[model samples]
Target: MRDEKWTARIEAGVEGLTKAEWAPDSRNILCFSEWGLRVTIWSLSTGTATYIQFPKHPDRGYAFRKDGRYFVLAERYKSKDMMGVYDCPSGYKLIRHFALPTTSLASISLSPTGNHVAAWEAASEFKVVIMNLTGQHIATFIPTDDPLLGVRHILWHPSGTYLLVGGWDSKLYILSSLEWKVVATIQLASRLPSSTACCTIHSS
Candidate 1:
């Protein structure tokens, strides 16, 4: 008794939706549910959905790559934090799982070139971690304390040469990817609110 004209809908007897997005390729729809414990990739042409499982619940720090080839998720397993890269074409199969040094489980971002990844730590204020796809720790940046506390967000430059880290401290930290160090810091007149942040990029 259902109409075929409807685009698509999740089948009954499943968990509710947490988040959804269209794959960059536009041919498929990616859905996350159970707080990242379950993923379903729905095909528009074939009208079928494939389910994928995660080892742990991915709270919020997760995003698919630009090319739709992969996705990065900061997952919580056994009370520990982990970073996972899953292959997009293979029903979201796990490709790599990197154990994070901290337990913040904050936001994560991938470099434009797909070579590096960065994560913000909330448990420890003003700490950012940089790493590669091979589970090797590249560098950790812990800047001087300010009124702004934990890192709120992380963004990578299009050139993949630098990163921008923002925090509650009312400042932005520009980090060099190559040198793995803070090259400059921009301070504001006021402390950034705990729930608010700023991010910008300009090439000179």
Candidate 2:
């Protein structure tokens, strides 16, 4: 019964899977809920799953390395922002933990090269913090002073030389990776409070 037989099944214990992302190697699955309080990763080869819980989070603040060797997250500790990097396969060891200056940090984006991570405020105009995987703070890009300046998304260019930061201000700031300066700004008609492929464009 080649056509009728079940090929495989995964018993992910997550009750409500709000979002799921596969590791670059396709050997692991990461699932999150709408609440953003917990995440579970299942190892396909080992048939085991591991979960990480958070005290609070404004958005899904985690990303897997391109090689799937480790994962990084914006974790909260005692009402403070902290970055945590965990090892793969086992997923229990906390290899690194770095304290961040702002508690409102959310929406994490690891650079394409997996060297730096960019995290921004979820509902405020706090500084966009950029740091390396070793927990060293590289730089911080300030948000607009306008009241409408809420960070919506932080995306690193494919070349990892610029960061495209957009938000409720209906504008995008292209920050040069070399100096972390705003190289250019693109204004849109509507509030850019979400990530979309159409809005992800390279700077000239």
Candidate 3:
């Protein structure tokens, strides 16, 4: 198996580095840089690249929705306590701006279904908030303890029934959409024998 994987990698040389995300159709890959503030689309088959100058901002992050129709572009200001989102392919249409109750935006994640967004803020405390695509606050889930680990990543289950949050503390949290409660928590390093050690939800 290792030998076969290596052979495929050599044949695919420099092909995968052109962009950060491959198009839903697998024809192109979308790429961007936080420092350069530029967005580029690269053709996977032809190796051609097209670049677009991104709007000026101190910090920027983007997520491509599953349908490939639009992208969520988040911008953080240098001196302001707010963040903004742009709805694309309409590019830079101010969807909504929210004032940070804290100091900075810790991280942002868009659900796979494209209906919701999750954002974490880090300041003297840690907080996570969920919002709808229209920028309305849907629900807010705050852990009792600071999780001591900041939110490193957030992902939505394909069924859109749950959100998985991974933190620097080496823990994974599975949250239910309907109840908005933590259904399960898996510790990073635990040798305990339990059925809840692994959590899996089937989406039909």
Candidate 4:
């Protein structure tokens, strides 16, 4: 589905775009804009759109639960740090928000069960931090090399035991949740001629 093109509109204009995930049951596409400020949930079947506005003018990051009951969103504002859970059927109301130690949020991913969240912050270097649903820090998954690669685009495996990450480095890393180690690294050929790549693990 990565190669297929869909239509979406931004504040500036409309254009063809690719999405991270499509809700099979609801026909909604979950995607963030290039700037990451606005997250749009679009209905492919009906051509309807819903826009969720962030409290602070920070970059937007989103994740969807397996059951599609709830989703998580993280925003980075200049003075106030924000993170919240939103009921999918309704609009974003505010589950939690806090003052962040830093000013930048690199990315955000939610576990398959919707019980935990993983977020990345930018400092001298990037750092991956995990938090529970109540807005409490649980642990940090620091990569051996640059954390930017793994945290840039993260997706929770179906089993919730691993995280799949890919980005500009052209390498996909499968990170183990138990030891927080990179168990497998898959590199794409330089001549693939694709701007982005994503993965989905199927069960037997």
Candidate 5:
């Protein structure tokens, strides 16, 4: 702070509050209510507040664009998985609201380019659904058919050319962006297999 003589007080809309965060721009604050009820955004510059209800998770259900121009939040509305995108600079205006084709959305991630969003099905299902800005379905992918497979997290590469998915089954799936195909799979294990042997590398 330029001067240590400035102070402002902000309060949550409800009594039982949980997670409180600052928007990327540092001009606004996001407060998540207890029991997944709602999120209140309090603006420091304008001294105003905005509320969004049914936040999927207090810590990980929302993401903001790198530049803070946009915000994507996952919500549960009417017993269905819904997503809302907000325009940050314009006072968190609702730019788009749409339903997702998922049973229980675990988490969501916005591509670095801000062109698409990826949502994954929660435990007991291994599904990742990608969608464009207009709410059109792009593709849904299941890395494995094992009944125990479940998606734990999903993220996009900084270049926005690849997507990385982590699973409860202990594996990582890399998907190419344009074609939306699994480019590689990285498996995690406690030890090497019996058939696997040590190898040597030679440089000439």
Candidate 6:
């Protein structure tokens, strides 16, 4: 990475901008407008722009596939939480859109291998739904027997072997990629997920 003076400038929307980040390709900038309204993507190469509505969360509600070819974002549509997958290189077209099975959907992420997506509900419910590219439900994982207090975060390992999930209940759940089952559960200190990063287990 090199530091260089940039000349490109993107003007904000009528509602003004909340946050902006470069797309995986490094040529496009995704600008999120205020109040979770819409995301305006400005392409530097093509000098073109595109927009998508109802981005659920500015930061964690969207993720790009590892290859940077497919883009997915969580949305709030007609009082329902939805997920939309877009084709980044194909003029940012809407390739797939469907409603997610959750009331308060917090975050949605594409797996490292690009074979599936993992999404979870916020609040006390320990509901994490796994689905394929076509919006087919592969599995639903509930780590605890009873409901948890809150879901802090969920991330897929870069190797695509394990999915790390944690919550306010102060526990971390490691799920195997094979069946999406809870392979191991680890207890944590009062200060949690932020401090826990990589966990290695030699034996399953």
lDDT of each: 0.75, 0.76, 0.62, 0.62, 0.86, 0.86
Candidate 4 residues 1-204, lDDT tens each? Answer: 579867664332453233446654556766555544566777666676776555332334566666776767766555555776767665434556654333567667788767777776643444666677777766666555664433446778987888776645666778787766679988867664344545555799
* Of 1 and 4, the candidate ranking higher by TM-score: 1
TM-score of structure candidate 6: 0.86
| Cα TM-score per model | 0.78, 0.76, 0.59, 0.54, 0.87, 0.86
The digit string of per-residue lDDT tens for model 6 on 47-88 reads 888999999997778888889889988999999989899999
* lDDT tens digits, residue span 52-122, model 2: 77624534677778877778887777778888898875554678988876767756889988899988776
Candidate 6 regions exceeding 4 Å error are 1-6, 191-204
Q: Where is model 4 poorest over a 10-residue stretch in terms of lDDT?
A: 10-19
Error of 2 at 132 (Å): 0.6
Q: Candidate 6 — worst ten consecutive residues by lDDT sum?
A: 191-200
For every candidate structure, what is the RMSD over all alpha carbons to the true structure, in angstroms? 7.8, 7.2, 10.0, 10.7, 6.4, 7.3
Could you give candidate 5's per-residue lDDT for residues 57-84 as a string of tens digits? 8888688987789899999999999999
In candidate 2, which residue ranges exceed 4 Å CA deviation?
A: 1-17, 33-37, 55-59, 89-92, 143-147, 190-204
Candidate number achieving the greatest TM-score relative to the actual structure: 5
**Clashing residue pairs for model 2:** none
* Clashing residue pairs found in predicted model 1: 148-168, 148-169
Question: Candidate 1: how many backbone clashes?
Answer: 2
lDDT of 3 by residue, 102-147 (tens): 3466656787777887877653345678777666777877776666
Which stretches of candidate 5 lie above 4 Å from their native place? 1-4, 191-204
- Name the TM-score of candidate 3: 0.59
Model 4 root-mean-square deviation: 10.7
